[model samples]
Target: MVLYAPLLFLLVLVGVQFALWALAQLGVQYAANHALQTTRVSGGTAAAGRADAAAVLDQVAGQVVVDPRVSVTRNPDTATVAVAGRVPAVVPFLRLQVTTEVSAPTERFRALTLSLTSPSPAGEGDPR
Candidate 1:
């Protein structure tokens, strides 16, 4: 019974560690997505994206993620955000880092112009 019990305990610890890792990964991904969305919108900035990511991490995964690093970039055409952090160690010897990146085109507003003249009949417009 002793041998079997230790084996069972180890298995349970491993499972719990895996769950923690998964949770951390998911949290980082969510933060990255939110940051990307914030930065991709019109008039958004990279600083705003980083701030948004930090806020999200603090609100959602503060305990699970440790020392999170957020990076954001914005340009004329596209925006990107990345979040990375180490997950709280569940097993004595195993430590894992979770990272996520998201990117999309920046939002822009353009003026649409309407045609001033109506089209002629198909046969009449044709040269033939």
Candidate 2:
């Protein structure tokens, strides 16, 4: 009976540790997605994305992660946001890392062009 009690206590501790890790994962993902959404908007720049990611990490995952990193990339048609960091783990010997990326299209409209040309005598004479 004493042995069973110890084992049950260990199991409960493991469960609690796992739950904390899961919550940290969710926090990182939410931060990454929010940063991406902000950067993908029209006139938004990569600098803005990085700033937003940092802010979110501080607000959400600061306690769980150490040495957080944020990266932002831009293309003609799309923008990308990446967030990465290390999270505290249950075991002291093991180090945990988390990374997430999100991308979205820029919210802008392409300008339409219209062209008009006068009829030429060469076109009227050529039936072929």
Candidate 3:
């Protein structure tokens, strides 16, 4: 039993590490998506996107993600957000990093003008 015990333990550790990495990846993706959504809306800014990404990371991957970094970029046509972080090492000397990026088209709002003045009767306005 002793010969097989170490192998079993190592397998279990690897599985756990993989699970943690997966969780971190999911969290990072979620953060990026949220940030992208925030920045893609009308009047949204890069700062707002970064803040939203940070908030989501804190809520979703606070424990698993180490040294989390968030970046947001906005242009006239598109908005993008990227989230990156290292996962806490579960096994000895095993380190993993997770990253995700999301982007969407920026919303554009057009101003509409309404004229309140009532038009005169079509036939009465002209002398026939």
Candidate 4:
């Protein structure tokens, strides 16, 4: 029984270490998916699109467990978003970092832009 106790404890420790690493990867995946959603909404624009994308990243950064170590970068031209962060492990001297990137097709808003340029904006002349 005495020998089994030490072996059991070691197994528990290893399990905990793996759990921490998994948690880190999950966090990164969550952030990456969120950032991708923002990029899709922003469409293909230089300023507004990037602004929206950044806002999404900021939201993820603020809410994730590893916010302090989180970093997000978005490339509008390529429609790609990357998220990276590290989660501190419960075990001393152990930590894990995870990163993920997603790319989406560009969305052109030329039709919307041109419509907005019309002399009379929508709902300006009609109440219905």
The whole-model lDDT of each prediction reads 0.92, 0.82, 0.92, 0.58
Q: Which stretches of candidate 3 lie over 4 Å from their true place?
A: 111-128
lDDT: worst 10-residue window of model 4: 63-72
Per-residue lDDT of model 3, residues 1-128, tens digit only? 99999999999999999999999999999999988999999999999999999999999988989999998999999998989999998799998989988888999988999999998888877687
Better of 2 and 4 by lDDT: 2
Candidate 1 local Cα displacement, residue 4, angstroms? 1.6
Candidate 4 — which pairs collide?
A: none
Error in Å for residue 18 of model 4:
1.8
lDDT for each residue of candidate 2 in 84-124, tens digit (9 for 90 to 100): 88777675465778788888887887799866876768868
As for TM-score, the candidate ahead, 1 or 3, is 1
Q: Candidate 3: deviation at residue 81, Å?
A: 0.5
Q: C-alpha displacement of 84 in model 3, angstroms?
A: 0.5
lDDT of 2: 0.82
Count clashes in each candidate, considering only residues at least 3 apart in sequence or on different chains: 0, 0, 0, 0
After superposition, candidate 1 runs with Cα above 4 Å error: 119-128
Per-residue error for 57 in candidate 1, Å, reads: 0.9
Sorted by lDDT (best first), the order is 3, 1, 2, 4
**Tens-digit lDDT string for candidate 1 (21-75):** 9998989999999989999999999999999999998888889999999999999
| Clash total of candidate 4 | 0
The positional error of residue 29 in candidate 1, measured at the CA in angstroms, is 0.9
Which segments of candidate 4 are over 4 A away from where they belong? Answer: 43-64, 67-77, 110-128
Deviation in angstroms for 24 in model 1? 0.9
